[model samples]
Target chain A: MKLDLQTELCRRLNITYPVIQAGMAGGPTTAEMVAGVSNAGGLGKLGAAYMVPDAIRDTVRAIRRLTDRPFGVNLFTVDMTDDLSRVREVQRMLDPLREELGIAHGKEDLRTPNWFAEQFQVLLEEEVPVISTAFGVLPDDAMREAKAAGRTVMTMVTTVEEAKLAEEKGADVLVAQGSDAGGHRGTFDITKHPYGANIGTFSLVPQIVDNVRVPVVAAGGVMDGRGLVAALALGAQGVQLGTRFLTSAESGAHPAYKKALLESTEEDTVITKAFSGRPARGIRNAFIDHVENSGVAPLPFPSQNTATGDIRKEAAAQNDPRYLSLWAGQATRLLTDGDRAEEIVKEIIAQAQELLK
Target chain B: MKLDLQTELCRRLNITYPVIQAGMAGGPTTAEMVAGVSNAGGLGKLGAAYMVPDAIRDTVRAIRRLTDRPFGVNLFTVDMTDDLSRVREVQRMLDPLREELGIAHGKEDLRTPNWFAEQFQVLLEEEVPVISTAFGVLPDDAMREAKAAGRTVMTMVTTVEEAKLAEEKGADVLVAQGSDAGGHRGTFDITKHPYGANIGTFSLVPQIVDNVRVPVVAAGGVMDGRGLVAALALGAQGVQLGTRFLTSAESGAHPAYKKALLESTEEDTVITKAFSGRPARGIRNAFIDHVENSGVAPLPFPSQNTATGDIRKEAAAQNDPRYLSLWAGQATRLLTDGDRAEEIVKEIIAQAQELLK
Candidate 1:
């Protein structure tokens, strides 16, 4: 009995395989990876987080040029905490380190580009098939708009409480971000709440399945076929893989970044905020090393991000490998040398089918 | 309706809950924390991972002086990969960084003292009631000797395969070290293994209970009475907590280490090898930050560890927070100001009773 990964995934996503090329921030989350996955009977997701409205529009257009297949867009829906005291405190503390890194350190205009609503409007205009958000639940109005526009809305949540919250806010699917997940957590309270468990897909998937009515998408550290079968057996409607795709030929990550991903093992990846003040899993490197060792404090999200952006960019440009952000998950070691999205899709589907039998 | 944590623990250990304060690796696994938890009718454990045979003897004796009650000692077993080539490669790779950290290079002895066998000899001589090994199962001779001497033997395993292996090796009890666990995983094949799952108390306890005939003790990211009750509800005979007790006043983690624990939120902790080459969860800090970014290849187990031992010791001695190995778990943020182990234990029991009803 071969598992119809595509059919099962489509059944769950209301699209094709319970496979999704996860949305990644920065460049690796390319139209090729997304469209390739989608074309191969899986969902490909474009990360629209931190993108300007124009960049998002152009990216959507670019994906459309490549494939007529369905794809999703992801954004950070953080409820901006009005308090700037902590942000200020963090900035004041990290100023010297920024100077040491030879990056200009002054008050970054700490303004969130009200790009989420604008991006949503653009996404609706483009008529993308799916939309997802991390950090918090999307507003009921936004959820209503997306659904009204005939798009499915998925939200990221780590805990059962957040799952319920997303559902209440009208999430069509729940992306359960485990602690082992790479990138920013879709957690609502990054500071106050602790990520609950080193919950493996086996344990967390079933519990979330038991708790929620919506289709559950198991994200975080899922790299290959065994993991995919395990997720489905544990009752996940689909498996969303981020780190695995980052090193694929279709990805647009810097050559150095992709190389680091190839080099990483299960032990090599770690969850750290030395890059962005927000917690994210990535390959251990020089930037992370310097920040973790420096007695200086880290600036809050965006500020700390903006402060170090130059150094990170320089490191990547120089192929320094050390300072570059190597965002990845625990399953990084499993990412082997591979081609673009379609081959990966076929490989995973075939192996997953084998495992189910 | 009250869940008897002690009774459940006793059933799992086939001993008394008043019997175990889980063995902690660093100084935080102190006589006070051990004696107090043991005194309160739960088993207290002395972390003997970093200790030499003589140190283990002295610490066991110290705990004996503090409490006439029965307690357990814990050790790491079988991390020495018999693959000499791989071991040599790892040591050779570590040479540069060792020199950078101002440590002697090319000691090349590569043999970490196999304290497990020696410690077993001391335990037999001293006649401790219970003994356990984390990471992997003890050798046949050690298990046989301990059991033959009327001592109870336990082994920690992170996966079912490992549990079965332990059972095959004649382990009397199994401690299920879930992925949420704070310390080094007792996984035998750290190189090729997938950390099974979030496998928290809820998911792990039941599965381990069903699969193995021996009693199961759940460990990892567990805190408070709610967690204890939940574990018991999932069929855990008992629960072992490291992070929760580490924050108690009875703990000997450096003041800075304790402070980091006290100040931690779920976001504050991440699994990293900035301390030991092995992945362990701890309060996020500069040591982790520096190493994470430096791209300096971390020395593998025992070697990577030996290289950093001086810096860690020096940092701890000088109370320089930057270099301290602040090993802790996600539960660090939940720890309140109270330091009394007895009070914490009583409160956990009391809270569990309240929730159980």
Candidate 2:
């Protein structure tokens, strides 16, 4: 059997394969992992959402030092809202957990850092090759600046409406993130509930591809070569995988978190707003269940996310995945133990080639 | 353009194309449409969930008269429960709409018809080549009888657990219906909330395929050849489509319903339990919004389904889809007007051929 796997995405990105290592926030996507994937002939993206300007520049420089291959940086465009009462309620709910974990209660005057602008400025200054935006649309000026700096702009969207808007606002690529995707949904409105637009990647990619002329990249629940080929068949030019790489040797995820993912089944993951106000897919644990059953509405994004930072940190330090956000897609079951980022890229491409043949 | 589109599903079902015209309940899938698709080299399925034993036998014979190609019959295996008070509540809520539509309020002793057993018997007696069970697993006895009669059994599942259970119960194939799939979800426990398992076809198919050795058939949000090829790449042996064929000339959908689907976009559909207690995807209309916003809980399956029957009838009689349940998948935007079932099968194959090449 002869199969044509080279897509427009590969041509535009100048990559050997249509697979992209997802830029997972809060650490799994490390500079080493990004460079490893890119060096192995697939595009890799640095998860720069939680990084400060200096950190972003350092990480980009580190990736450059590792490999001169084309890579991308992902940032979050979040709307900051102040709702102290809700934040306080969440803090109250987490009081017991904090006590149990021996962590200090988050301060009442807790503030979320707005680092997106600084990160964007760093990307331009560093002349990043590609940029991917999640949580919401990239600001027009930022998008323009990136283009001016010879960067490719890709906007992540959970719905076709957002895909159209991103295209209209000059997106070179659309990352159609499905509900099964790990991490926060790329729904444009941070204030709107994320679960309302629950279109899966299989359904989302084709519709987005049909509605937009730009190349579409399928994300969420994609774990292997079959997934990459499947996305291409759905009219997508490429696929972005996150969970499969969470356990990669170069990934920054805690060993316990990686172990939990490896031992888990597809049904183990749930979409919850516990770790963050926005819905995200993660392995279900005590913390998620507690927050859901607590009857306390979570504070809006960034606030709730910030409030839980201490808990997650302590959980990671203790090597306990229960209180930590084990962000992984529904396809976590497909992940294999001991696969390096470079090996993962090569294995996926090789398997896809054999299947296509 | 040459494409080897023959999949395991096609070989197992002995069909020329790896496509199955979805057995959409509440009309749209007519005997003529089923036969047309079968004659056109794709497996066509009769939506026999609402038919009595005699009607089922007659429809099977009617299809046999139209085409000798292999086809399938779909039935709902729902566990019915009686809750008169809840039924009355739905009736009371719809009283105003009933009067507005010049429809009579449902009778006090309104009871759901129990015809599944009789329908199964008809299927066995009629020697239906393929049997597809929705809503629940096919009983062991039924599965045995179907297999004894040389009938292939396909179970529809919304989750991987259900898929595993169905496979253990002797399912020859699995139809992995994603959340974006139109019509009632095939969740086994009718009492369990349907929307809780929000897996999309893209996400659901591969996971289910990974869990079960049986060939998986991808359903929901698939509208054309690209979708068919995509499902295959996801490890699905074939694809089942619903909304795409809603406007086929041979489809039983009302002209207004067909028009609504054709004019609609992907965002026009909503998964709501307003029409039936079980959540189903359909084009948003006045009825859905009214029932959803009315703050009244719908009665359980079969009861609420029966209570709203009159309003839907009246609405269809008036050619008003606002009141009628215009069931369609999220891929309604891909539907075109006036294509015949044969043309649809041919077009899908042709388009897929070009793309695969």
Candidate 3:
């Protein structure tokens, strides 16, 4: 009944059952979950999305304190139009929201911080074994550095076209993100594509595997072993998941947030851009209801994200469910409370093994 | 560029090209679409779900007049619970709406007519080639008689457990329904086993294929040839789609309905029990919004179905938009108006052929 997912995934990743905890930047992913899963024979990921260089260093050190197992740090190698006019347009859109949130309009410092450089440096300094990215493929320099350090480089892609692009960009593995995947779609061109043909893992994985020579890491609504087995059957070398691990005891999600996920039905989740200015699947609640009803055009990418940052932080501090960004996959309802990550992983593998024959 | 989907699907179905048109019991699935697809070398289905025995007979005969090709008729084989108490309970939930709609009371005679008997008798008289059922499997006597008469039998299942059950009950073929499948889920016990996990075609097809000796047909969200190719990769013998053909010029879908489906995004389609008592995916519109926002408890199955039958009829008659049941799958957005059924069949096959390598 043992599925040997580590062995299968390791062999595919050139690692052990093709299991990797997805790098969720905002929450659910924690040092403990990463360390524990990695220690138990699957890869764990550190979400260094919001981390500054120093924080990334400290977090890597923190994870190193617990286990010697290999873990990864996820980055956002976004390629925005370097046109300053576009950046200013985004800045102008945020001015009103800043005033509404009780902040002054003119702070003289209009420039955004260079968080990407510091974070990447920290990963290099820590000699992390793996590095993953979203939005776009990692820069050539980063790929070169990661390769020099003998680290695995993974990239998330929503379509096979994107998969080929990532492979061309020197990605070691392709994380084929299905439409059912929670969090932001790691599409290379959202503007031209406009999110058509939301191929699920079952549809997307095989196509990516067939199109690209690189090993495919399936991501999206994979909650258990049955899903993992299906991914493998579809030609994925490994499976990466987020929501399934979010409700585990080691996850950093709020108690209310985790409880809401466990109690949700499949109907309760919807894909919305209300929270992070990016399309993500989560449990539908008051905030989503407002977004659906309000019809407010969300600003582009990091700007809308930055503008909502204060609101999200305040909502979390106040334990206000309406303002919290509940980023989760379609299988949010399947996540159980107080469950050990190891038990969940083992159960998935065992159940899949039961059906394999 | 040319895909011989007909030949391929035919090969897979153990019939001619593997295309199966929906048995849409509503407005969209016309005799023309059915006959056209069938004549073009694919299976056409008559949606006899909402029809009485006489109507079903007429529709079947009408289809036969148009084409000599083998076609199937679909029916609802749901087990009606023998209690009228629930009807009253459901009426109580709709009592307030009755007043708003200017009806004295929300009262309708509870009836589960022997439509199956009537329809089956017609098929027997006409010697139809295939008969499929949704919601649940047919009775043993019916299946036995259908097989005895040399008709192929197919049933829809959402899980591997259901696949095993269908095979046990003399099902000739299994149509694995994923969560992305538009319309009512074909679950035998909806209250007991809520079909939440989207065991998509890629995943469900292989699992069912592995578990049973019977051929498997993949359903739900299959829009293009890529989907067909992916399904075959997962061991499905063929694929059945409804939404893909619903928008074709040959279909009888209302102008508004077809237009709405054409304009929809994947995000615009949602699964809700607000229309029928059961969960079905459709375009998000005013009617869905009203029902979702309404605090009324839905009646179960037939009772709730009857309670809203008047509103749906009136809505369609008035072209009111707020009361019509816009049944469609999650891939509704991909459907373009003026799509030729023959071209669609060809496109799917062509895509699959290219992907096969």
Give the best candidate by lDDT: 2
Candidate 1 wrong stretches, greater than 4 Å: A1-9, A79-112, A194-200, B1-132, B135-178, B181-357
DockQ by candidate, in order: 0.04, 0.47, 0.07
For each candidate, what is the lDDT?
0.70, 0.84, 0.70
What tens digits encode model 1's per-residue C-alpha lDDT throughout A250-273? 888898888888876445666677
Model 1 scores a TM of 0.58
Candidate 2, A1-357: lDDT as tens digits: 224568888889988888888888888889999999999999999988888789999999999999999999999887666567766678889988989899887677888888878888898889888899887667888877877777899888988889999999988988998877876768887454455366767778888888899999999888888888778878788889888889999999899999999988766778888997888888899999999999998887778888988999999899888899988787776888878999999998887786677
Tens-digit lDDT track of model 1 for B164-272: 8888888888887767667676777657543323333333445466578887777775566645654554455777888788768878778877777776554456677
Worst 10 residues of 1 chain A by lDDT: A194-203
Best by DockQ: 2
Each candidate structure's TM-score, on Cα atoms with residue i matched to residue i, is 0.58, 0.95, 0.62
Candidate 2 or 3, higher lDDT? 2
Question: Which is better, 1 or 2, measured by lDDT?
Answer: 2
In model 3, where do residues sit more than 4 Å from their true spots? A1-72, A75-121, A124-176, A179-218, A221-357, B1-14, B80-114, B194-198
Model 2 global lDDT (CA atoms, 0 to 1): 0.84
